[model samples]
Target: MRLWQRIFLIGLVLWLATVVVTNWTGNSNLVPTVVLFGSFLVPVTFVVWAYGRGRSPRVTVELLFVAFVVGGALGVLGASLLESWLVHPSIGMYVVVGLIEEGVKLAALMFVTRHMTKRTTMDGVILGATVGFGFAAFESAGYAFNALFTSEGLSLRQLVETEVLRGILAPVGHGLWTAILGGVLFAAAGRLTTTVMLSYLGVSLLHALWDSMNAIAIAVTLALTGHAWQFALLRIGRVPHVTEWQVHVYTLVNWAGLVAISLVALCWLWMTVRSGRRRREILSQ
Candidate 1:
């Protein structure tokens, strides 16, 4: 079967699993709805968009699709299993989860991208992002659904807010991060022996670091406040002054930073192929 066909099949099966689980519970939730849509549709659209932009390989798109499904499944399972062991609501939990999820997704990426006939730095980044995007989409949706079920008739606003934020800021949990890893691995496919291992570990560590920062902040606040109630009331009750009247200034700032980093990453990825593409075109001419 074609690579694109394989990706499509995996995506279909993943979507079906999402539906089956929701049906089994007989409960509908907003986040789940968002996850169902974002996890399944976002990557689909991304592949289309990437193709339309003339950046991604259509023939190998199937590999990306498979990466998304397989990695996404592992992420969900890892996050759930780790959540159970999160006895201390500290940076440790978040870091551990981020590492596990990213690690799982990256592993899947390596498997799918292995020994391919055509390999490029951009292709690696694109595939890695595809995996991350799939994982983040479903996870975000699952969270949204849980929120809706516990509250009023669907937290549409929250769902939109998280989706928009994550979608724009972080396509997959560790999207921009993993893209760097994939790019490196792809470039060193034939030249290096231990580069792939180093790249994977580096990406995973960065992911864990990002999550740990947030976890530490929350943990510190909880500890200093002496009580969760006081922490919620006194610390969270007050909103600081900041520029931009956008939704959740804090979130926007974080997203902005993430996007900025992504821009740098993109520049690096573009450069990796620039000379190569130019060389190819020159030869053809």
Candidate 2:
């Protein structure tokens, strides 16, 4: 089997084991252990895969570590502060969050690699991924923590379920989005060119769409089921006594939206990589 495939399999197996052990044992201490392992699984797997694929001598272990650790921490810290200060609770908040997060990550990437001169698209991908994954890992931990406690006491099952869902979705979210932006940023040689600006905005919009996917699904569900779309706003804290057919419809649309977003991000990454390769070829000639 391929290296990345092997890594992915190992991560997946370990995650499943962690989930099973934590839930079966109902151990509180094991909850964080499981959360950390599950959260880091896919992001770490993808980072390693990117590293192998790049095979760039420019991307050193120190650099990757710094990018992942420092960059990710800074991105999370900055985004949290800025989001709290700048964003209010509203419909547009998700879009604002995308802007803040993508911007902060880009800034974190810049800050982490400010001294490095020989930057390439591959370096960007690796480092951007490091930052993105770092952000994801921290963010997932927070979400897992929050998911642990509802009105009830510690909910290990809820925590594990949240981690599993986020872990499954992590690769296509922050990591891919930032990688695309980083590729464009490095391809432009750190200049804020039109392409770079547009790429950043485009990725931010995709980020917004991703964060809004559940709401969008709910809206669609309400509309298609002949329910008032405005009632979606009241969905919070109140589980509607919907028909089985409605429930199925909501599930189908939600999963389909998530899949669609994943495909879009993947396609964006593929195009960015292809563009980077072409740029390299032209420069080589």
Candidate 3:
């Protein structure tokens, strides 16, 4: 009924229609069409949801745009540089990537909000959602592009599949984590305190777990398949043939891990919002 809800519904319908049409026609030309639509669907919906959730003093359109566009671009660029320089094929690589990414996003949040004299927790939530979704959109685009290529050739199906999966998972990923960090950062009122550092570390750990789920699943599968689970397994390409039972077990564990991590992140975000609301209420009293 609200504007954001209506917009999200419309976007969803349009995205579904595009997917149907593109797949029916089997036109490679429409690859980009579906990719962009599907990639933005989840991020946009979550952003609208965040905007509607914070019915308080609204964040300005200009600031939200800067956070979504400029902040997102900066996050991607910074994360890429840090990941390239510091990350390698290792069990711990996901942790490093998570720390770098969440760190850069927080920096981007500060960059966008630095000029403001008064910022509230809600402002951080909305702006943080914008920046996170922006990062999601850009990162999804890159993943979609890469999905087009495979061992065989151009794979439109794979591209669409990648977009859809990432889009579905986008909300609980970057956006949620950043919102938690942003809420804490703003509550700190620019103070470098232990609480802020701990919050950042917590979100970074969530990010690491989210990113490392697949690797963890594989390790578990390998162990069950009688292959000794080693950190080296993570660095190797093309897992040795897994049994059908092992495959099923891995799939179940992988999906469960994903869902568990998402629920944890969502719980953290909900707690942050509740705490922020309480703080505001007490301040007003």
Candidate 4:
């Protein structure tokens, strides 16, 4: 089997084993192991796959590992610090978050790959995705850790659910967004071109929309079901109890929005990769 396949299979087995042991033994000590495995499994697999795809001379395994660990660490730290200081709960909060997070991921990518002389769009995609996946892995681990605590006590089920959900959506989230930005950045050959700026804004918009999807789905469901009064309740720190039908509608809307966003990002990445390959071919000829 390929490296990515091996990584995913082994990681999944380890995660499952950890979960079973934790459940059987009721050991809180193994919670961290479960969280780390579940959180990092998909991201590590994707990074390995991307690394295989590029197979660039300059982008060695060691460099990719550094980018994944150090770059991801830097991105999450920078984003957390900036978001904590600057962001307030508001309508535009997701937008600000998107801008800040994407900015930081780009910065981390640049910081890690700055010394490389021959940068290409593919290289950027691989490395940027490495950093992004790194961020996702770390951030998901944090989320899983937080999910362990609830109003009552430690909730392993919630932690597993959070990790599973985030793991499933990992590829289309940070990794996809940063891959687009990275492709554009490298296509410009490190220049701050208009194309690069536009790509950043586009990805940031996608990020914002993604972050706000839950709220958007709730609002849309409320509107569709003629529950406009719930909006007022929401404003005054009241969460109106939703009906079964409303819950179904909300879930549908939420998944639909996520699918739409994922499709858009995937298409953008495909086009960007195609364009980059064509450009490279032209240059070679």
Candidate 5:
């Protein structure tokens, strides 16, 4: 019914599904409670903050929630489908995958939270976080599950450390980058501001670049190594039953890139808001 209510319900359901599946697969104990909570908590908080900021109608917020869920499912599915033909799938080759996923998630946010005002900047930031959150929630489940269900469980120390790092980093990963889209585009359509869509395109491009970084890296790696086999790309839906340097790169780089993107988004939002306020003051005189 309400946006927060729906987000809570969807989040709870996904969490439960994550726990139950891990349990069945013998990775139950590997599920870090803190990591799971942190994964959902940050983004959901952003969603709540956005709700207060936009005063968007109840129905539209619900749609945003749906965007999170539906967009994630579609993103993973698209990734899987695209990788079906290749030796393994990667997000880099198909920039469309990133664009479509973030675009749709942000679109849902923009359409539902429509309003034209500089005042909605914080909401934009929050919703951008929400989009990232939705993507992270699903993505985390896959990673956590991979860690747990493999032949052996990670040591308690390793488990604790990995989860802690991931927890700390999760907010910035997919959710914040997508949040840039949500934040800027929402501002554009609602605020009647010039350069709004252009700014949004910039945000979206950053998002696509964020996904493509590893792909590009892998390609370079392949070329330099002079390998004929497709050893450079990440093999999706297949964990090596243990973490390695390459896997670590994939995990940590994604986290770091998103965090960097967030810093950039924050700067953009800050400038947009300050300039808008100055413009308003000038016009008021």
Candidate 6:
């Protein structure tokens, strides 16, 4: 079996064992283990897979490892600092968040790969994906950890659910976004050209739309169900109880939005990869 396959199987087994042990023993110390393992497993597996698939001869395992660790750390830290200072609760909050997060991840990728004399779109995709997965892993850990604590107390079930959901969605999130950005950045030879800027904006828009999808779904549900007046109640700190049908509609809308966004991102990445390969071929010739 390939290395990524091995990593996924082993990591999945370990994470499951950790979850079982923590739940059986009610040991708080093992909580961190479960959170980290569950959060990092998918991202790590995907990164290894990307490394195996990447054709850039200059990109090495060691560099990918560093990008995954250091680049992810820098992205997370920079995003947190900037978001805390600049973000506020508003209609455009997710948009700002998308901009800040994608910006920082790009910066982190650039920082980690700064010394490379030769760069290619494929290399950027691999390394950018490494950094993005790193960010996703760390960010997922935080979300899982927070899910553990609630008003009622420790919530292992909630934590597990959070991890599972995020794990399932990991590939279509930060990894995909940064992969697109990195391809553009590297295609421009590290310059912030207009094409690169447009790619950044495009990914950031996707990010914002993704983050706001649930709310958008809710709004759509309300409108469809003739409950749009509840928006006023929400504005005034009241959450009007949603009908069962509305809940179903919201779920459908939310998931449909996510699927559409994921499809678009996947298509964009495919085009980017194809363009990169063509560029490489021309250069080689």
Best by lDDT: 6
Error of 3 at 247 (Å): 1.3
Candidate 6 segments whose C-alpha is farther than 4 A from its true place = 228-237
Candidate with better lDDT, 1 vs 6: 6
Predicted candidate 2 versus true structure: per-residue lDDT over 160-238, tens digit per residue: 7888788878888899889988888888887789998898899899999889888888779888884553366355655
Clashes of 6: 0
TM-scores, each model vs. reference: 0.61, 0.89, 0.89, 0.96, 0.54, 0.96
lDDT of 4 by residue, 127-184 (tens): 8899999999999999999999999999999999999999999999999999998888
Candidate 3 on 1-285: residue-level lDDT in tens? 987778778888887887788778877787777777877777877777777777554477777878988999999999999998999998798899989999999999999888877767777778888899999998999999899999998877788789878977887889988988888888788555898889889889988998888889987877766455443554585455566888798898899998998888888778887888899999999
lDDT, candidates in the order shown: 0.58, 0.85, 0.83, 0.93, 0.56, 0.94
Tens-place lDDT per residue, model 1, 107-217, is: 666766665766666676677676666676667667655545434555444544555455555543456666666666666652434866665665665566555544344
Alpha carbon lDDT of residue 218, candidate 1?
42
Kindly report which residue pairs in candidate 3 clash with one another. none
What would you estimate as the lDDT of candidate 3? Answer: 0.83
Query: lDDT, candidate 5, residue 271?
Result: 73
Write one digit per residue (lDDT tens) for candidate 6, span 20-72.
99999999999999999999999999998998888567898889889999999
**Model 1 regions lying over 4 Å from their true place:** 1-35, 54-58, 82-88, 114-118, 151-154, 190-193, 212-256, 271-285
Q: Summing lDDT over every window of 10 consecutive residues in candidate 2, give the lowest-scoring window.
A: 226-235
User: Model 5 misses residue 89 by how many Å?
Assistant: 4.7
Candidates 2 and 6: which is better by lDDT?
6
